[model samples]
Target: MAIPRQQLLVVSEELDEAELAALKFLSLEHIPMRKLETVREAVDFFHVLQEKGMIEAENLSFLKELLYRICRIDLLEAQLGSSREEMESELQLPGRAKVSAYRYLLFQLSEDITEDKLKSFKVFLGKELPKCKLNSKTTMLDVFIEMEKKGILGEDNLSVLKNLCREINVSLLRRIEEYELNLSGREEVLIPEEQKGSTGGPKAQARGQALSVASDSPGHWDESSWLEVYKMTSQPRGVCVILNNHSFAKARAAVPKPKDLKDRPGTHVDAVALRRVFQKLHFTVAEHRDLMADEIRKIVDIYRCKDHKARDCFVCCILSHGKKGIVYGVDGEEVPIQELTTAFTEQNCPSLAGKPKVFFVQACQGNACHKGVTVETDSGQQDSSIETDTRLQLDYIPAEADFLLGMATLQDFISYRSPRRGTWYIQALCQHLEYSCPRGEDILTILTAVNQEVSRKSCNKVEKQMPEPGFTLTKKLIFPVS
Candidate 1:
């Protein structure tokens, strides 16, 4: 039997350059370095695997494993006819994995290495690798390949890589150390299996005892259990600070003719919704109305100075007029969104480190209105007219980990509002939280639902609004409903 060439071609077309490089990197152990170097496209790499007998119609386990390892679950299911659950179960059997754990570790390191770190790595290895391979466009994956060719990095060798990571970023060294520990544990588990039925020495008996304990515990070897989740079980989960700027009278008075900042009338509805939902979720809600830009900074600093060691998370909702990278205060002053978010960084607020800090901003990112595309709807009814918050700007979230900034709309687009009803983004967000939190849905999943609901809505049959959620969360954040 032969695998369908058309299916491979279609899947190949879906892969971008980075994904192609990832697939090739994962295949280094199975295919020769020379063949992989010549394989530039995904289809060509698949052909090399097919020729090497690693993938065929009857045997596609290796190909499926490659796709699964690269986190391409979509392609694994749609094209390869294999699900993640099936792959997980199959890989549980020892020696079924074609990709070594060491290889996967290196690939993950490459993925996480920043561009600046990559340049540093190239400079450090300048004397070791060929000068031609260390160009400006060289990625971490390419650097890893060069190191492997130099015989410094391999399945059993990671000293050079560890030293490089230690110099570049101390935090990254933890990954390599964890990989080494897990690799050692796997070796201990395999000793008993390989030397079964022998009168093993004292060391062998101890290994057997360790294996017995591991076998008894179902989650002992479960890799997914290694992932740490944000602890959200505190009595009062955290504080929910709502900065509602409904009266912008001072802004209107200070700004000149064309740039008049109007009062936000319907924002109270959003504030009420947020307060109710977060309070129901057991957060201590603090609602501040009509604040100046300086006042906003002071309030955030007050919260930042608070002892949040017992808290599991923090939440802030800013409802005001905003421009690119800033929100306007009631007094017509600009407050940088980055400044507000960075106030809670680990350095400034050590008590809140490793906890999720969520910010939801309901304001126009810019003056430009988003035009809607025609879509078939089941409802025959239509809204004749709708209102909008005329304020405008873009958004900003800090680069640090464990922060999430949910914007009302994309940059340069005006978000919708109603004189009676709240904003399209905030209302939808509250609705999703109210519905999904009790069901144990994570924050990102809830935000995606908000995005879908808000994008479907249109004002005056032409203007549409799409919410955006940017995050650097390192774990699944599920709000406690009780």
Candidate 2:
């Protein structure tokens, strides 16, 4: 049987001559799975099938093929370089970024889980869970339950999610289905997925059951498949606080001012460059020069009091001298890095709950340097509510989930700065972010690439520096330039 005339007309208009010919032959031959032309076309074709209730057991294989093809197309496009404006407009689509507000609820399920495990779970969500998007409102089991009850999940959505759960531990999914969370605003407006995963007729259900695959391992999914799994919008615009401490004096300053005449705080090369970069990514860059420890906390605290409900995420960068676990203020007083980070937790800063809080620290974690060996193996905070709040001191919570810390250097090594080029870590970071962020890379993946690039560099008389990232994020944090 031919595709409905109306659907065929739309498909023909969208597909080029070659794609149209291929579709016609496939329709005649009754082949279910084959490589398609464009991601845009594949998605459209799938929609037409779902609408017509023609998604059968045969179509499942086609579904897998289409998803993988979409990934390849996306990766190919990312590797291609168009004009800056053209690239941003084309890549950073709205609703593409994932920021789960119910992250606190997810945290409740496993207070004991490690960061590495959290990262793996995030990968599963982004890659395995089809038609599943997370945001600030997902705090309880009811969201999923309610969707199922209301007949919002289609056969295709169920098949994919079931496969996802089977591939992973699925304990997380169970906890989500069983555990209830104590959170404010449990009920919020939700969108209707009428086009795809909405309630289907009995005919569609029969088609889905026939096509169900029993295999547990993720099929046709590999590293390259991630290209379709993650879509970042550079539009998570909000406050980007820069605490650049450049000057210092007697009493052996804690974070010494930049000694490099060209790269020092006064030159503001890193600061300026960072501003341009974040602005390009849609953040409102707020630069604070030479802040004392208390001053830095106070500024971030003030931001905490303001409403971040309108913003998609928060970013704070500290550039200064440092040792072991803290960075020094211009006055030489050290502020515990943990203190700056815990202030934005969901319990502490309700306004930012479920949104990303990103911190990039540019300081030496310790007084040592790194030396790279050949044939290398690679491996890969904010503020406030200080003072009267007394919350952090009592609870001692680390930065909440959805927070990312991209340190300038691995802990305990002095980060290098040139008299002109700027600090090695931030410069490399800024460079990669400029190139990668607009292309829709997740923050950690982007940081990993930055680490790889910086590790190859030699600064401070050929001493090596490495950038490290510490994250409690439960979902992929994509920075698609707005």
State the weakest 10-residue window (summed lDDT) of model 1. Answer: 204-213
Q: What TM-score does candidate 1 reach?
A: 0.49
TM-score of 2: 0.46
List model 1 lDDT by residue over 1-482, tens digit each. Answer: 77998999988998999999998888788888888888888888888888899988888899889888888999999998899999999999999999988888988988888888888999878866899999998999998888878756666445457656766987788888777656543452110001112222121010100001111222133543455678899989999999988776776567453235667767788898899889989999999999998999999999999999999999999988775567878887888888999999999999999899999988755444222321111000121122233232223666779998887766544566655556667767876676557656577767765665566555443455667677888887789687
Tens digits of per-residue lDDT, candidate 2, 1-482, equal 54345533443354453343333223321223232323245446655555545445333323222222223233223322223444335334644212122332332333433455445444544422333433333322323333334332221123223223344546655554332221111321111000121122111000111111112221222443343322234355788898887665421333354221111332266798689889888888899987767887898788878888778788888877665467766555678777888888887789888778888877754433222311110000111111221111212227456777776654434455643445656766776676556555566666765665556544322345666676766666777665
Error of 2 at 391 (Å): 27
In model 1, the Cα lDDT at residue 441 comes to: 59
Q: What are the lDDT scores of the predictions, listed in order? A: 0.72, 0.49
Cα RMSD to the true fold for all candidates: 25.1, 22.6
What value of lDDT does candidate 2 attain over all alpha carbons?
0.49
The regions of model 2 sitting more than 4 angstroms off are: 1-236, 250-267, 369-399, 460-462
What is model 1's C-alpha RMSD? Answer: 25.1
Task: Give per-candidate clash totals.
Answer: 5, 11
Q: How many backbone clashes does candidate 2 have?
A: 11
Angstrom error at residue 163, model 1 = 51
For residue 410, give model 2's deviation from the true position in Å.
1.8
Clashing pairs in 1: 323-393, 324-393, 324-394, 365-393, 366-393
